[model samples]
Target chain A: MYRDPSDVNRVASLGAGPIGGGWTAHFLARGYDVNAYIHDPAERDALMAVVETGWVSLTGLGLALGASMDRLTVTSDLAEAVEGVGFIQESGPERLEIKQALYKRLGEIVPADVVIGSSTSGLTMTEIAAECETPGRCVIGHPFNPPYLLPLVEIIGGKQTDKAAVDWAAAFYEVAGKAPLVMKKEVPGFVATRLQEALWREALHMVANGEATPEDIDIALKNGPAPRMAVQGQCMAFHVACGEGGMATNLDQFGPALKWPWTRLEAPELTKELRDQMVDGCNAMAGDRHFRDMAAERDRKIVAVLKAVRDG
Target chain B: MYRDPSDVNRVASLGAGPIGGGWTAHFLARGYDVNAYIHDPAERDALMAVVETGWVSLTGLGLALGASMDRLTVTSDLAEAVEGVGFIQESGPERLEIKQALYKRLGEIVPADVVIGSSTSGLTMTEIAAECETPGRCVIGHPFNPPYLLPLVEIIGGKQTDKAAVDWAAAFYEVAGKAPLVMKKEVPGFVATRLQEALWREALHMVANGEATPEDIDIALKNGPAPRMAVQGQCMAFHVACGEGGMATNLDQFGPALKWPWTRLEAPELTKELRDQMVDGCNAMAGDRHFRDMAAERDRKIVAVLKAVRDG
Candidate 1:
């Protein structure tokens, strides 16, 4: 039987690059004694530098009780790093073969019930855990850059992984001060990354076509939509913009614009089925709040964000 | 001779919908007496409601000296609204025919030197001004929704528009407390809208495919990239993520992911020329600030925003 995520204490952080170092800092800030494994001992100084830099923002955000840098332990021996840890977070290189070999080794060293979460942003857990004897306990816990600051950690389970392990990882991330988005099904780049890449590609197209420069795009985004998006996501923002009518009103008003050659990506046709799904989805997100109330909340948050940005 | 944009005190706001009403409120908050034109008399209450609600947030953001909502005047007669006004902001229907007819009448009413800025997000200035007698004075001053709070105003000129008019409009927006992105060339949806549409389409695709729910996307975005994007934009955010190496290191590190089918939208080829342009653009945006300093500033702003969000 696996130990409940709440009962887990010490954790192993494999690899100490940017993502790995960020995870190490995050785990340490959460009051966990971290055994950080690096491939080469020469990276020790650089890894320490990341932890120190990350600690500043973590302190500002408030550190967990009993959190200290002294609790961190670094080593080059893989077996020593994984010894007696309750959980394992692997942030190895983005290579299928390397990850398979690493997982295979990790599977043999750790108990069958110990969860191993890979931090590979590109490769999926399905491929990474292919050679592991205990693939059922392996999952993906992808974090955005500067993981200690950003609250999102995308949780995905591979084809062979057990659902219980995915649940355990999600609960663990939540306990560790993260908003874990447990995906229903695996997709390329997951949620946030896909959305980001789509917008990024469009920006690149504009620059390549000479429609706008990089600086122009940045100014347009930061000044126009970025602040609002920070407060409310795209769908909710549009729903609130239509006032009391909500998503149905928004779709009717601007759905035709989606068909317009506004973006290079061809939009999925707005069939009635898709339309209903979106309307219902937004309604569910809104819960019992009226459009006016949601709009007020959005406005309040936006004001706070603008003030913060201005003061900073 | 046209009065300079700085000297313009009273302006005409044609149409009384959300965009026009928001613009009316923004202009009033900026201490301008606005002559608001509406086609129907029944829309008076709705327009007033928008202005009233917008005022609350505008007040929170701080009002300009001598600002007053009582300075606004509503009129049904088009000719009466444009009379003696120093500038005109037409947010009439998005249809090209309605706008062309409206612009033709306005061109006949106002002085040839008086600048006219349209808030049309879809139709281009070139198409709208084709029927006008003085197309040279007409320019696009497209704004995002809830224009009273958001600071962006994209300034683009039609083929027939004079360069001086675009300059005057950009200068005027600055005086009105708006960040105007003067586009080098007009493209479909311009910059911000295109970027937004690309992301929205991908989001729709995800929902239609049952890969994720609206709530999941919202949580993923708001918790992950939205806060950072609020501080530094997409390009600069990635630039800072790579630390001291800036864009060059970032492109070399994650540029391959652009081709990874991460998004439905196809990415532009990352050619040598494109890479150079992106690097130079980011370097220009960074100015003399070192990467460490920029990263520190970004963290400070993000922390402030997170605190505001949490407190709100």
Candidate 2:
């Protein structure tokens, strides 16, 4: 049903927004001929612009042997775009009905054995696969921002998804130089997003209370836990912090602090003022750079970190 | 009272345990003459072992000019460690009584202008400065593990702490290649540690409930948020996730989900079973490597990340 990444040369991107365009750029950079499908004809220009911008970023990260911008093909015909692609990555709008309808249409076109992965961030594959003709082949292939650079791809399967398909997608992503973590359980927002949400909620609470600024929070992570995080996982690092006591010592020492208000997991209300603050704060952090330029800069930094993590 | 990093030749480590030894190694790597105070005469060999181990990792990260183990001087006599040093870094112990007693003794010995920094992770500077005659000079200069590699040093001031002293310490740390985040208002765990505690608490709960393994939780971070975390803060990354919508869209979309059971900020009871699983999970992750070896590897990787972040 599936082949190695070498054999699976053509991949289909079933939406050409930022996430979808990112998938296209990543696939192209991985030397896969990317056939992108879009509902609107005007999107061809904007989507390809994203691909060209991403291409430069991927180049800084280093591309595959046969990678090129010429590998991207935009098509108005949905069936034609996915025709014989070994893999289908869908990044449609977040609406359930929209995704279900797209999956139903894609199922009718793509080969039944070819794996179809949804880049849906929070939606579960179980719900998304409900309308697919061959539910067993559908799974979540969630990638972090600027997919060509950040290596993590969460491989999650729905109740109907075949474990084999999940394994195949996981293996394929690895060959494409992505770190894929398979979730045994289907948790909303997945693990990373869940962890991220906790910290994010806490940050918002701080901003609302004026305890800290957004720039301060960003600087805290970029210069602090992240440098350590690039090397070892947070829990593993906590294990090291336990000294002779291991996690047991850390748990004993810091466990009580959890009951304290260290983190406000419950989000602050997004009042008009708070909303304005958050937006203004982020804009200030971005400063003069355009989003694409900031993204390219992010991709460059991520590449360096990835290289260090791999080589070290 | 403080001089440029080049002019400030000597710094003192009031304790020669893991944290103190780390400070010693880091100070030495920054080309400071490090005088380390230990409780027992027999502790010198073990303390030096830790410093020597840290030096190799720091050297790999690129050592400062004149950096060497030859610059480290260990003594059991407290006065010998702090008498001539420009700054004092106290990582003695967590017990408030022990730290207060030590600070009182140091206040009587060291010069009033020589700033004394406590590496106490959770304890506030005010509590630690209670017994010090010159409490204004005492500040919290908390460093993450393997301080030579990780850039963050949380600089906090006590109630009696002079604003100028805090500013001076912040400036001094920046000169030593450390990113200092000054706490405008002190909380229980401070910023990074507070954020870390929330994630850690949630991770423990997941493991306790059999929802995820320790490795699963760790892989989730290393693969998912860590790469992103290496570059941007979690909050900044969330800002990017909002697309053109920015932070307001992110909040509108996901803020309500915060009430969901994504993170259990209240930690699970540290039952024997949970503790054993945690220790065993971390041990399995470490495999045959000794703690020191694991620490060394972590140091090397952190150095790589720091280099990437700095250069990229």
Candidate 3:
């Protein structure tokens, strides 16, 4: 049987690119001994440079007990890197064939009980693990860029992935100080990327239409919605914005505006079913907190964020 | 000639709803003597309540010299509110007819040189200023909710508006502590709202499709891109993420992802013209700073913001 995630103290970081190096730095800071694998030995200096840069920010965020850069080891041999590591993170190039072949090798080398999490932002794990003999252990543990600073880690499983593997990965990432979102269904771009792409495409359209410059769009966002969003996401922010009435009042007031030609993307029809889902979801998110209290908390956090950005 | 925006110390804030009341509190905190007009006498207390709520945040952000809530004066009579004010901000109901009639009365009551800035989120300046005789001085000064905290104020002008009016509104908003984006062309939702709506609609689709819940989406955003966005907007953030190569490297690496079916919105074709526009815009935004320096600055600011949010 695979050791519990909390009992696994060593990790294998496969790939020497930005994402892999970031994972190496983060794991080391969390007091884990890391084995980092690279295809080209000449890229060793570049990977270490990435780790050195990441270490500054990690130190600022604080290090775990016994955390040290010396705990990391680099190797060019694939089998050597996977030896005795409880967890394996694969962040190779985005090409499907490259990832499939790598996963096939990883499945043969690593213990069957160990979980292998791919960090591919584009390719789904189902496709990447197609050649793997032990596909049930392969899952997606994607992170945003500069993974050392950002806390999000999206956990998704392939069609052949076992539920136990997904749960194990989630628990491991939590212990590693990550905010994990274990997806229930596979979709293109998952959640955050889809939302980000939507916003980014609209920004490009505005520039194409000569409505605003890129700088104008960025300034508007950083100064307007971004700070508040850092405190609370869009749904909860609007829920709090409506004050005591919460999201129900927000829907009544702004639902019609959703039909306006505000964006190029077409909105889903606000069906009764969809409306209830939204209201219920927001209520679940709010739990017992009153709208007034949430709004106040949001305002307080936004003030702090604004000050931080300004002072920095 | 109208008094210079820097010399405008007294302003009229018409309407008493959330937007108007937010403007009232902001102006008062900036040390401007504000005359607020409401249609209903019963709303006076409610208006003050909004101001009181805003005052807590405004004070936390630091009050300007000589700033005090006592500088605000409430009146039900529209004429009394406009009397002797140097600038006017109209935040009445969203109906075009109501706004047109209000603008007509505002044009007749205030001097032609005094710029009338509307805070409508939906209606365009051209449509709202249609019935006004002094349309040349009418402009849009739309602010996000809780204008006292968020610094962005998008300034737009109608076809009848003078260039001087747009410039004047931008200057006045800056003097009142706003990061103003003076738009070059009129669009339906302006810059920020279009971007925000695109993201929001996509989020709704995700929830509707049962891919994720509202809480899941919120957790993904708050932990992923939102905090970094608070420090820098998307364009600059991506530019810095590519390291020494800047935006050019970023485009070469990830531009293909734009063609992927990641979002429901159709992206504009990545023509050379658009590419050059984006690259040039980012280069101009970067100015004299090297990519490494900017990345360091971004990391520092993001760290501060994350710490602030976590502590709060």
Residue by residue across A89-182, what tens digits does model 3's lDDT show?
9989989999999988887888899999999987888899999999998899999777988989999999899999999999999999888999
- With a 3 Å backbone cut-off (N, CA, C), the pairs that clash in candidate 1 are none
Model 1 chain B: ten consecutive residues of lowest lDDT? B303-312
The DockQ scores of all candidates, in the order shown, are 0.78, 0.21, 0.82
TM-score of chain A of each: 0.96, 0.80, 0.97
Cα RMSD (angstroms) for every candidate in the order listed: 2.0, 13.1, 1.7
Per-residue lDDT of model 2, residues B96-129, tens digit only? 9998898889889888889888899868888888
Which runs of model 1 end up more than 4 angstroms from their true locations? B77-80
lDDT string for model 1 (A177-288, tens) is 8889999778888899999889999999999989889898888888888888888888888777777778898887778878888989989888888888888888888889
Would you list the rank order by TM-score, best first? 3, 1, 2
- What would the per-residue lDDT of candidate 3 be over residues B1-312, giving only the tens digit for each residue? 667788888999988898999999999999999999999999999899889999999998899999988898899999999999989999999999999999988888889999999998877888888999999999999998778789999999988999999999999899889999998787878888888889999988988889888888888889888888778798888888877777777776778878888989988988788888888999999999998888888878887888878886
Q: Looking at model 2 chain A, report the run of 10 residues with the lowest lDDT sum.
A: A266-275
lDDT of 1 by residue, B68-143 (tens): 9999999999888988888899899989999999988888888998899999887888999999999998999999
Recovered fraction of real interface contacts per model = 0.79, 0.47, 0.83
Better of 1 and 2 by DockQ: 1
